[model samples]
Target: MTVMRRTGWFTKSIAAAGLLLMAGQASAALWSITYPRPLSENDLRSEYPVALLTLALEKTGVKYSLLPSDRILLQGKALRQLKENREVNVVWSMTDAQREKDLLPIRIPIAKGLIGWRVFLTTKDQLKYFKAVSSTDQLMKMTPVQGEEWPDTKILQANGFNVYTVPEYPQAFSILQSGRARLFPRSVIEVLNELESDDLPADIVLEPKLALHYPTAMYFFVNKGNATLARLIETGLERALEDGSFDALFRSTYQETLDKLDLENRTVFELDNPSLPPATPVNTPDYWLRPTRQE
Candidate 1:
């Protein structure tokens, strides 16, 4: 929603100011942490994550510069660049076995596990059909749409789901609106943001009854050899957690969305994520969003 748009600039401004405060100090270890470019000139989804990264650096009291790539870099390309130590040195993405091995992951999920909780986006007419689904077998009866190369596709397929895929992620929205697909499972964190667009069909709405859950650990990854920078970020994040600033930032950024979803009251269909790396700190209760009524 425009909520992040309004508050995000101020957060960014604070981060920018924090960066200015670090100018001219300890030039030897001084490093430039480049992130992926914005999806568009106005894309602001990265605001919270960026702010958290800045807060981590601020906590370290280190002289570092945060810059975006000169050109656009999608998730795969960004991760590749980070692995190659090219244009970007940092990227925040959901962790898998290969990614954790190729780069250093901070282990703390940047979204506090909100990225794993998913809900369906479907046309108005599909409400009754979805609401009637109380079991995984019933849910899998209808195929849902996902991005072509997304890891979620493999996860869903492994769970016996026949997921329809689109080459371009945005095409899933069109597929739903045109009745070409019955459902499009989207991260609960992203559903509200995607709905704010004025161009989407009015009939498309969230299917609230049946929700999907998995272990989605989004971490800030740097090259495996960049141990110093990795420690800097991890230290900052752990400090933020200890002092409550990390939860504060997370709640401020996502509580509104979570409250609207009322996830605790819904029937959560838990799914397995074989892609999650062995190093993921799933045992750390404090690092996840554990709703009281999860099923």
Candidate 2:
């Protein structure tokens, strides 16, 4: 009888332990993250927010899954669906005012800054016409791309410039090159990259002028209902930044790309040096790790 009672007690204890283990496993949340584009050989993977989130997961022991989208539009649509169904957990690098109301942001920023300024590019002979146009207002008098949400287009239209919106950035450039349009405004870095790839003729010069400055911030957005996961990611990112792990990971992945792009010599917004900043001594909470959500 004594032996039977001992055996029964042991069996009950084992069953209770098994039940607890199952509960823990069931409570482990699974997240689906959407990226702005598919992974490509030339894609800037190191700068990708999804990769950073993966690193954060490793540090935090969070379970997650990824679903890559081909474009920003698809990502927005998928994220919206997920939000409506309460099925999606995270979306990366989204910027809009409406998204802020529904999503919680991870404190670390994904994009460097809001791109401002537009350089007018054209063949050398035509540069004289734009020499006096120092600002968007002055340049608005010319016929440009219409219906596009380009940085300077709306401002130019408001100021009485005939604006045309092309379907794509490359199309706009092509139009300028083919003499269909007289000017094209683009970010300096983007234009430089394009010029490096295509090797434009000596006549093509990018005019230096401030066009428009817009406010934008990129972040890892989590559904507001998944507050626990959001908080965990935020804390994990903070810890990673504090321990120098995040910078090390970024450098290991991106240093070669930076050198290739000639951006190695250029300073990142936060660091004085071109190299990645040490994650430790990151004293400013709002400086690097502040969460910002946009609609």
Candidate 3:
């Protein structure tokens, strides 16, 4: 009886060890990635990326671990880290010629080209001024604000707009509030939430008349040499897109913001993005989101 009991106990121990080994191997397969910027109290900024990354990896059976929110680094520092092939493995950004040359871009617009449409955030007092403006040339006469290193700043300048740039994100709001910059361009997906945020200045209002359009699109980028990782992301994204998973994720994430924008009522002022790379697949209509045409 004692010998039988020992044999049973030994079998159970071996099974448990095998299960532990499998679990460890599974965990080891997950490639860790992170957002380049620190996560704020606002969940909107991080949620979209997390959802897309998760689904993309799952589609390809490529396991990944997104680092905790606290592990993020500033954009410039993150870019540097990617260049050096250090801790940070992946990032997402608006594409430009220089960035395409330096980083391996996944080339798929994660936001379905929606990131290219911008809405202005202006002080309540300045609202009346924009209400009278009817064209891009007229709008350019007024000062617009952007992040100091943002590709949008260069694009705006190339389009003949005088843009005020600040080093920090919050400073852009302060500058707008101070009337130092009359227009602060924000992604249409982001502007509504910014207005509702308790931390945002109460005096700023979304400009009602115009929506700025450009040729730019945001893409997932990695170290130029990390082609294997880039291929993994690209294949996953393509499969997700074909399976309707990508569209589902995008709509589920931004439906509220799209409904709120009432895009049909606003005039779109299309602008050129000179920095857009030759490799951008602009012909892919399936990858873009379009506003409903008004009757």
Candidate 4:
């Protein structure tokens, strides 16, 4: 599906105008939040978080509107909203020590650890190239492309993999398609849908038998000063979990994708996330999606 794109300057102007208009409306909601746009052309994963968050908020009986935010320059730029106290109230990302300290995190794995499983995007011809490989050592020999500011790029480099870093999201796929990089790793929930939605050239295909595993989770982050919003999210998410709505939504939204991926038949290479925060609830079984192993 096509996602309408607006430049950051225009987006901020719209947001300012929207707030002004919202203030004058008698029926205006109690809460307003913004979401990031698709990272790739015609992709719609950007709206996935919106749906989950909306359901959670609805459970709290609080009226809210999820708007599209300005394009972000850095993944952590949203965290700066807390310090600068901007209007961008809620954002989500992989957790890190500095991020947890800077923003209020709900501490639940919103995607059920789906962000940690990676499926690589590569050219069709490279299917044979990958088939010839047998181990992480061989895969590491192939260059991977990632966003310049993404923490995953740093994690890959730290693990001794050669990575091509670009400053923007679209450039990573372009670089991979142009053969400058052999692979672009994306989450399991992301890769298949992106390929389907992007209308990408026929040359691009998902590497069928490889999956990368790491320790990470996407958490809903709120500004540190916005304690009310934080409590609303925490309470709402807890209710969803206790009522099994979270798991039901998870299966409904992603079970088909996981089934299509046939994860059990793939080679699961576990990678070390040295960047994972110490405060992460690694031992909390109820807080994560542990489909592959015993907790």
The TM-scores of all predictions, comma-separated, are: 0.84, 0.52, 0.86, 0.83
| Whole-structure CA lDDT of model 3 | 0.79
lDDT string, candidate 4, 46-162, tens digits: 666777788788777767777766674245555576456774777878776667777788788889888988989998766678887778899899999998767688789889998
Q: Which segments of candidate 4 are over 4 A away from where they belong?
A: 1-29, 39-41, 70-83, 293-295
- Decreasing TM-score order of the candidates: 3, 1, 4, 2
Write candidate 3's Cα lDDT for 148-226 as tens digits. 7788999999999989999877788899988999999889767877787777888888888688888878888889887
| Best of the two (1, 2) by lDDT | 1
Off by over 4 Å in 1: 1-29, 199-203
RMSD (Å) per prediction: 8.9, 13.0, 11.7, 10.3
Pick the winner on TM-score between candidates 2 and 3: 3
Candidate 2 lDDT, 1-295, residue by residue in tens: 0001125888989855754564365347675555545334333332446666777766666576766554433344545654664434566542443555556665465433322223446666666776576455555565565325332454455446676677544456556666666776543324554454433454566544323323333457776676656655665665676687776765565445334433222211221211212321234433332212222
In model 4, the worst 10-residue window by lDDT is: 19-28
lDDT of 4: 0.76
Query: Could you give me the TM-score of model 3 versus the true structure?
Result: 0.86
Candidate 1 per-residue lDDT over residues 95-135, each given as its tens digit:
77777778888888888887788988898987778767899
